[model samples]
Target: MTASEPGTPRTGPHRAELDLDGVRDEPTFLDRCARDLALPQWFGHNWDALDDCLRDLSWWGRPSGYEIRIRGWQRFRAAAPETARTAADVLADAIEYWAPRDTPLTVTFDDQE
Candidate 1:
């Protein structure tokens, strides 16, 4: 799964790329998500917090749609399969939450490093 990065600024309104090139644990994964996704300041940096933020991206003015591209995730998955599954599930849930509301949220994976 891959998509070209838009020419827009790396602010809250464009696709957020989380490059987990070396991330191998939940803590690092959370930190990478916070930085790459530009999560809100009030973000609690936890699984629950991540779910809440992804569900409501008001911080980004709740764009008409949202896309998240995950790159270099192979290492993380191999290092910690369980956490990787949980992370994928959370993202999937976020997509489900937005689909019914008309605001599509797509999560793509790009492990071709």
Candidate 2:
């Protein structure tokens, strides 16, 4: 049965992809984020800025219950483990930021490349 089928439960997370191939610096990471999420021009390309935009994703008009998957996550991790950890933490923060509303937003790092 399809997701829209009446009997099918709406229990799955919406999937989005963020490519991190050859992204080894802050600027590239920010650019990738902006492109992946189609963030606004006001994004400041910093962690706090990222957090702000992430929390404000209602502008995308996307429904609740979504998990954005960062593809080639291992590339980022290999190039800069600390930065990768920071990204993961920020995503976790975003998840928490929306949890109170029962939106079920989250992110997953996929190392499959």
Candidate 3:
């Protein structure tokens, strides 16, 4: 089970090839998350917010960050749908509030040494 691009119609194979930097992985983040969490597969509509959060912070390598955030958010939402909704609302508001800031946002992972 995999989440197709949000709002994009899916037909054909249950799995689709993700054109990553170059490598093709068998199970995409959406696929694995749906399988592991047993949630109705749905592409995250808030992908852009998640992507910006990741890129600004430079967490995992870009590829890994995409996978982690997508999967993590899916799992989170599945576990607590209400909380997820609240989080999404907060994130949206934050983006609007922060948009006018002149300084670039920076995110750092403490785990990185």
Q: How accurate locally, in lDDT, is each candidate?
A: 0.82, 0.78, 0.35
RMSD of each: 6.9, 5.7, 17.1
- Residues 42-82 of candidate 2: C-alpha lDDT, one tens digit per residue: 99999999999888875555454666888888878889888
Query: Deviation in angstroms for 90 in model 3?
Result: 0.6
Candidate 3 local lDDT, 1-113, one digit each (tens): 22234565533312212222211222343344234323332324244444344234222212211221222454445555665565455445544544454322222112211
User: Worst lDDT window (10 residues) for model 2?
Assistant: 1-10
Candidate 1: segments with Cα more than 4 A from true spot: 1-13
Q: How close is candidate 3 to the true structure, as a TM-score?
A: 0.31
Residues 12-64 of candidate 1: C-alpha lDDT, one tens digit per residue: 33478999988999999999999999999988989999999998886765455
Order the candidates by lDDT, highest first. Answer: 1, 2, 3
lDDT of model 2 at residue 35? 89
Q: List runs of model 2 lying over 4 Å from the truth.
A: 1-14
Clashing pairs in 2: none
Model 1 residue 64 CA deviation (Å) reads 2.2
Q: What residue pairs are clashing in model 3?
A: 57-107
TM-score-better candidate, 2 vs 3: 2
For every model shown, what is its TM-score relative to the native structure? 0.84, 0.80, 0.31
Alpha carbon lDDT at 20, candidate 2:
94
